[model samples]
Target: MANTPHGGVLKDLHQRDASIQEELKAKAETLPHITLTERQLCDLELILNGAFSPLEGFLGKKDYESVVETLRLADGTLWTIPIYLDVSSQKIAEVGIRPGAQITLRDPRNDQALAILTVSDTYQPDKEREAIKVYGANDKAHPSVSYLWDHTQDFYVGGSVQAVSEPQHYDYVADRRSPAELRAHFKKLNWTRVVAFQTRNPMHRAHRELTVRAARSRHANVLIQPVVGLTKPGDIDHFTRVRVYKAIMPKYPNGMAMLSLLPLAMRMGGPREAVWHAIIRKNFGASHFIVGRDHAGPGKNSQGEDFYGPYEAQDLVLSFTSELDIEVVPFQMLTYLPDTDEYQPVNEVPEGVKTLNISGTELRRRLKTGAPIPEWFSYPEVVRILREANPPRHKQGFTIFLTGLHASGKEAIARALQVSLNQEGGRSVTLLLGETIRHELSSELGFTKRERDINVGRIGFVSGELTRAGGACIAAPIAPYEEARNKAKETISKWGGFYLVHVATSLEQCIKNDRTGVYAKAQAGEIKGFTGIDDVYEEPKNPDLRVDPTQTPISQIVHEIVLLLERDGYIGER
Candidate 1:
């Protein structure tokens, strides 16, 4: 029999009544709305769909504290991760949020209302405690901890949510299923024992070996559950990873494996995450879950130490096995045995026998260099899918973002680099100059800080698309603020290599080279909120490269940048 769901019930909260849903939709329009971030949207979807089986809404203060401190809910149910509805103070005031008030939760992507929350409590979270307790580290190197401190807002509003409608996902609609739906699916398939595999990465040969071994050992079918929502930075996008997953399905034993997409925003909270994953798999009707070494672990902290012990995930999951309902299947490193032409556990291998293993880093290096991945490491189909998404670095796309004061020669160098790239004769090159963007894309925006950030973000968006399509993007924007520039870098870095070049032209030099006379106008009060005049410019503390255009000609400066790109594997030999 399939394992029971967490909390003994699937908490699918979507409104069933058309009239009530319509009424709620009507009321939601009148109430102030809070726009959910991508992570929160993922959480909301899981909540409504019962994938987060017991969570009907974001956690209240007591539940939040309980989950953080005890890894359980207020009702003493085993729940590891805390779901939050974090919002800014400005948003709080805009919504007039209070204990009794209702706030509509809207999807920013489509401007549609998804749920309504009766505000139970609003309070500031002790992020340090959250980081330390939930992630076992208050270190910024942990992606979730960094998000808590940096990207997350100041306040957390908690309540029970009433679903107006389920969020629509157009992509891979067939594979997305609620907990109840998936349980029904398991029943229909007559699979008594199901072993779910949790993955956020592309599956290689070793992964297939371990999963197949797990299923055969347990006498269970395989449920390949992969995260489709936000994962760690620099991870492959879900679209590409899904294609990779789809390609690998045929390699599994016939009718032995099935694919399902989990809209989960991973915390990378090693042990806690493993427990949480087991619960989710249980809700999905899986009888067992495979917990490998360092499952869901974020690599390292800034202190050069691992956040969790090597086997902590397996240990923690084992500790919660009886309560988790889903069986915990422990896994170890599988090595390829050339002599037997199969994979075996390291401990089972004969001493002095030749073994082959490819590390994830090594695989990525091979992909970037277009090096051959032996069939022992991955299937040819899987390799082909990965190569399509991650072409050789020389054929890949890249973005060069130049930031400095106005008249800082950013535009000059950008145009020169654009020409140089054009002469190289491979991919198309686009130059997004500050003045040109302001004139074309952001005509209505002024020189205010917010407007400048928006302008820079626009350039970043366009650059990301171009980079994704395998073209060179040169964006010369006076991206004065670090936060916006960082946002831009985050936006483009997912698609291809993103380099932030600080055009280190001094304020005095800018004034001297002011052919446009805009800086003079700003200083003379003719232009308001002009950067480096009425406004302050924050110098980049960690730029990829810094160049002084005053000290070198544009051609030489472009050459220096080309050399940097070549060094970073963004380009190849002339």
Candidate 2:
């Protein structure tokens, strides 16, 4: 028999009655609408599809309090996470939301209405309490806690929903199965026992071996269910990860495994999250779930200590196995043994046997350096997909940001570097000079602190976009503030390499070299709030490259920068 859904029944909220759906569609225009955020959309999809088996809609205040404090619904059903529809005061006023009022929930990606909510109540939630009780910390270092504090709205409105349509997904349509659909699939396949492996990261050889071992040990087939929703901020995008997953699927024993995508917004809540995952897998017709070491752990805390013990997730899942109605298969840490040419569980290996393992950081470093990843570590196809998504540094995009005082030779060096790069002719180069930006991007913006920040932010946004498209961008600006420069670096680094070059040309030297008399005017107080005069110019404490135009010739400085780029593999060897 297929595994039973959570809470003994799968709650499908979609309006199957064609007439009722048409009526709701007609009423939707008159009803007030709330645009759902990315996380809320994930929640709504699960609720309507019955993946959140017992939840027909977002939780009311009573159920929210119960779930947060006791990890159960008000009716005493097991539910670890609190799902709420939060709105701002401005939105509440615009919609005039209150008990007994009905509103349409519209998808933010498209304006299509997905569901209708009849409001049961609206109340402010204690975020601090929610963070501490549910996520085990009130610290912003925890990704979910930071989101609760930063991204969530002030008021939460709760009610049952009447779904009009499911959230439309253009990608992987066939693989996005609902709870009922998955149960039907299992029934058709006659798969009596299934073990699920859940992950947010890309699967490698070790993960494959571990999941296969779990299935073999339990005499069950494998389900590779990877989360495709909002994961950790820097996680690999689902598009790339799904490609990797598809590449690795053939390695599984034929007819012994299957792959599916789960659009779950993970909270990284460690032990509690592990239990929650098991319940969700049960609803998907999986009889067992693999809870690996540090499952759903958010990694190190602010003090650099592991947030949860390696076995904490497994232990917690074991404690709730009876009530969850799903077996918790504890993942064994596996490492490749070079002599045996196979992976073995670390605990089962002989004491004197040599073991080899690659850390995620080391894997990325190898990828960036174009080094070979051993076949023992991952399959060639998987490596190929990863390499395509994240090319070698020399083939990737980058930004060279130059900051200095006015008339400090920044623009001259920037122009020279642009010419040199264009002459080299491997990739397109874009130069964003301070004057050009002021005239073009920030024409109405002045030199006040806020305006200057706005100017730098606009430059950063453009640079980031260019870098993402594999182009080289050189930005020369009098970005005197450290915060704005750092913000630019952070934004650009997400897409490609970001190198900061500080032109540490002295103020006295800049004044001496100023044939335009701009510095002289500033010194004479004719120009107020000029950098290095009335306004301060905060020097970069540790820039990637620092140049003094007075001592180093422009040609030599550019040569030095080229050498830096070459050394970091941002360009080919000279």
Candidate 3:
């Protein structure tokens, strides 16, 4: 039999009556407006769709406290995570939010009204306590903990929401399913036993094998329900992941599997998240949920230790199986046997047998280097989709960041490299020199450390955008701070390659080469906070290419940079 919805009943908060909805829509304009954050939008969608069943609205303080402390609601329903509508104090003052008041929740993206909230209570939450209890740590290393401390609003407002309309989505419309829709679909297909496999990453052969095995074990149909909501930082974007999922869907046996998209903003809470996910699956009419090792665990903490035990999520889900009304399918690690050309669980493999395994890091490295991804590890169609999304380093966009002291020949080298790259002529080349950026982008900015950081950050942002669009950005700045330069690299590397070139010309040489006498004026206290004189120029600890333009000719420095770019596959061989 299909599992019952959580709390023994699915709560439908949508205003199905057209007259009521029209009345609410007309009244929403007169009500106070509150903009919903991304997380809040995801929560609202689930709440309206009955995925968060048994609860008719965002939790009041009592339910929030109970869930945070004991993984249960105030009514004793098994709810692992607290869902609350957080608002800033300024927003509260603007909206005059109070008990018995009504407010329209506007979508931040388009400013469209999605729902209306009847404010029941407004109060400040103990974020630290919630973090420690729910995520097992108050440290910012955990993504959820960090969000709670840094991004969350100062006040939480609890209320029952009247759905004005479902949030708009333009992409993958056919794959997005609500809890009620999924339940009805399962019933129509006569799939009483459904096993749901949840994932935030791209699906590969191992994932397919694991899900298939899990379904076969329980004699159930499989649901590939991947989260399209906010996942960890640096995760593959949903567009690419969905493309990969679509490519892999046909590999499953006919009528045995289905693909669906879940708009879940994962908390990466590991054990608690495992229970939460199981409950959500149960509400979606799945009879079983797969709990993999380290389910929803954010990688490592600051001290380089795993945040949760390997089997902690599985164990926790198993313990709550009865209450959750869903079977817990524990996932085991799978390995490829080259001799048999089949994937087998590690425990089932014979000792001393040869097994082929590819780590995620290795796959990414291969992708970046234009190395071939074996079919045994992932399907060729999936790899092709990934490659299209994440092209090889040579084909992708990139930024060459040049940092040095003033008059260290950075501008000359930057111009020469720009000319060289333009001559090569495959991608658009943009040069962002210090003076040019100052005049064009940061005209109002000054030379303070904070201003300098902001200026560099702007350059990084621009460079990242250009790189993502497959352009070459050459940035020349006396970005003296290591932190700022590192931030630029981290930002640009997300979409394309970032190569830092340090022009390590000595301070004496720079002073000699300063035809404008800026360094001399700084030494004489005429110019305040002048780099390499009043202020310090921290040398790059590790740069992709380091050159002293004083010793190496301008052409040679440019050649070295081009060589490095070509060697790293950022450009074709000259």
Candidate 4:
């Protein structure tokens, strides 16, 4: 039998009529809009499509508080993650946002309006408290907790949403299914007792074995519902993962398995996130969810400690199974028995039998070094796809981001580094200097902190694209702030290595090195927002490489930076 949707209702919120969509879009154009970030875009889609059933809109204060404190909604329903629309106070006040205000939510990819929200309540979240309760720690190491403290704003606005249109996704149209659509598909196929497998990473042989085992044990068909929305940072891009999924589709026996996509911006809240995943699967008509060891875990914290116990996710999901209306199918870790050429549960393996398993870190090492991935560990086709995506480190791209005070000699280092990179003669090296970027990209922008961040963002975008291709990019900017530099790192690291080189040149030396006399002009108040004069240059707490240009020669500094890159395997005698 098909499981009931959460709250016993599938809340598909999109308006179907083309004329009505046009009318709503026209109306939304005149209302004040809060542009949804990429993360918010992912959440809005699920909420609109009933994958997050019972969540008609962003959570109100009561629901948020209830979920944070107790993992239950105000009505005592099992709801784990706190989902809300975070808007900045400046945007709120500029647009006169308040209770009873009707506002439009615009997509950041474009200015197109997706929904109209009737603001019911606005409140400042106790972010640290929420982090501690929901994530089990107020540590910045947690991805969502970091987002809450860094990227999220002070105000959260909540209300019911009137969907004008669904966010447009050009890719993977066929596999993108709303909860209602998936339920209908299951009904059409006469599939009862569906087992759902959730993953953000690309699957391999062991994963296939475990899912097949879980499904057969439960007498259920398999549903591979992988997250296509924002996954954990540095995860394999969904396009490659989807291709890998397609390659594995034929591996399933008979017609027991199907694939679909979920646009969930994961909070990485571990145990809480597992319960949330189970609930979502139940809504999508899955009777059972496969919760494996360390399910949805974010690895380790900065202190080199596991954030949660290995079994915590499965335990939490099992505890709530009765209320969730879904069965939790627990599976032990899988390893290969090479003698038999089969996979089995770790606990069931005989003591004398030899077993093999490849760790993620080890796999990455093998990939970087172009080592052969054993067939038992992964399918050749899947490995080929991964290899295409992740070339050997020497052939892959990378970025060197240099930041320092004005006249700090970072520009000279950037130039020198670019020259050293090009000396290899195979990789294309591009240098982006802040002064040149100011002329080229930020000509209209000013010296304000916000403007500086925008300039840095532009530099990051360009360098990131350059790195995405098979090239080396060196960018020197007086980025001045950790937030902007971190943003740059986030962008570039998605494609390739992002090395942050901090030129720790003293202010006095920088002034002495200033032949242009800009520092003198800044002291005379001609340059208002001069960094290290009237403005601040927040030093990077843990830059990959910190150099003193005043003490180290340019050639030696460039050599040190290159050695750092080579040691990390971005370049070598490949």
Give the candidate number with the greatest TM-score.
2
Clashes of each: 0, 0, 0, 0
Q: If ranked by TM-score, best first, what sequence of candidates would result?
A: 2, 3, 1, 4
lDDT digits (tens) for residues 306-350 of candidate 4: 999989999998887668888999989999999999999999999
Model 2 scores worst on lDDT over the 10 consecutive residues at 1-10
Give per-residue lDDT, candidate 2, residue 312: 92
* Shift of residue 538 alpha carbon in model 2, Å: 3.0
Candidate 1, 269-309: lDDT as tens digits: 99999998998888888899999989999998898888888
Q: What TM-score, over all chains together, does every model reach?
A: 0.87, 0.94, 0.91, 0.84
Tens-digit lDDT string for candidate 3 (1-574): 1234532112323425668667878888788898888999888878877787766688989989999998898878888888999989999999999999999988888988888889999989999899899999888899999999899998999988877777889999999988888988999999999999999999999999999999999999999999998899889999999999999999999999999899998999999999989988888889999999899999888788888998999998898777888899998789999999999988899999999999989989998888989999999999999999878877888899999999999999999999999998889999999999999999999999999999999999999999999999999999999999999999998888899999999999999998998888899999999998888788889999899987889999898888888888888852
User: What overall lDDT goes with each candidate model?
Assistant: 0.88, 0.89, 0.89, 0.88
In the range 123-201, model 2's lDDT, one tens digit per residue, is 9999999999998878888999999999999999999887777789999888888877777888898889999999999
Q: Give the poorly placed runs of model 3, Cα more than 4 Å off.
A: 1-15, 444-451, 480-483, 504-546, 572-574
Instruction: Show pairs that collide, candidate 4.
Output: none
